[model samples]
Target: PDILHQLVKGTFKDHLVEWVGKYLEQVHGKTGTKNILADIDQQIAAAPPFPGLWCFPDGHNFSQWTGDNSKALMKVYLSAIEGHIPDDVEHTFHAFLEFCYIVRQNVIMDQTLAELRDALAQFHQYQEIFRMTGVCFDFSLPHQHSMLHYDLLI
Candidate 1:
């Protein structure tokens, strides 16, 4: 499967973006303290505009996502989610995004290779936050497993 299409726009969008929303709702729904999802949407929409980065005025609420949209959202997602979620969940996303950016480089040196392994390892270590929070019962999804093949690709 193509990394950009399958992993970036597909699995990450569904699991991290959408499921994170669901997780936030589940966490905040108990006390009815505030609309955490809406807060997230607002915070994302209010993200300052920069030259090349796309501004998510509507946040991640769109009905459909183009490839470019997914890529752009990835740039802002970690920051938008930083303080709102648990540290482990943030670490999971950070590691995944780190792996994504690192693998995108055209030149993969020995250091980059080692970094890839570390990033993927960190991702696996923290991803249990999903199951722990009940956002996912299992990480059995097909697209999710494809990232494990990156080393073989080298």
Candidate 2:
């Protein structure tokens, strides 16, 4: 929840704007990271331009569940969530972010249905990582290579 809050205030608001600027650069047939960086200013100028939350609705029991003086249950649930929201929204945002990335990947990038699903899966794995336990975690190269090896259609 805190991560969500920080993202809302920090990255999401700013990144979306930066992404828009990149979009414009792509529209004008720009290339390279520096050219993409040029769009940051324009993207920031457009505020609240996107749609919907990138997380799930607060749980159905959110209101019904209240903490007692000990507040143990609240502590447990909060700890479990760590820094991420439910998989649904995370993946949605992943899709949205990926669409922005791939579109700008080319001088004249376009969005496709396949890309949308791929983005969702990208975020899904991101969320799944948090659920892992008792494993020697190496997030850099091995994970990326192994993910590709699986015939999982994302």
Candidate 3:
């Protein structure tokens, strides 16, 4: 579970950075080139040092179970990209954050399953938007590598 969590977290970070970089390049063109790396750096620097679960000591803290940590992380991403992207694009990011919130929550049983379902649905929607806007990302490395080794298969 810990390894899976780390994998998901790393994928999220990579996808987030790639998505933002591609979006900036597409929308801003040449003038945006110089700031792309800076923007990505800023956003990454602002993000939480660890996945939401690890933010809590010993992975036991549940006081912010309502997804405050996820929301805070989203706020940092939004603030970092302020005045740099379109409103609709920003809203898509908000939806992405909501998906992240669902994934970050530490719950079980029916609620967890339901949240996972919703998160998948939201991800599909966000993915569609990304596709339409030409914001490409390669988020399949983990799956590809996992299939290479029997023991690493998930």
Using TM-score, rank the candidates from best to worst.
1, 3, 2
Candidate 1 residue 33 C-alpha distance from true site, Å: 9.1
Query: How would the candidate models be sorted by lDDT, starting from the highest?
Result: 1, 3, 2
Global fold similarity of model 2 (TM-score)? 0.22
Cα shift from native, residue 14, model 2 (Å): 8.5
Candidate 2 Cα misplacement greater than 4 A, ranges: 1-11, 14-82, 107-154
Whichever of 2 and 3 has more TM-score, that candidate is 3
lDDT of 2 by residue, 60-106 (tens): 12344222311222112222222323353345345435533443343
In order, the Cα lDDT scores of the candidates are 0.81, 0.34, 0.50
The lDDT of model 3 is 0.50
Instruction: Estimate, for each residue in 1-154, the C-alpha lDDT of model 3 and write its tens digit.
Output: 3323332333334455456667777877867745665664455464556544223232212344233443334445565666776665566566556644554466555665565456545554555555668775443565323312312221
Best by TM-score: 1
- Show pairs that collide, candidate 2: 17-43, 54-89
Sliding window of 10 residues with minimal summed lDDT for model 2: 69-78
Candidate 1: regions farther than 4 A off: 30-34
Let me know the TM-score candidate 1 reaches against the reference structure. Answer: 0.90
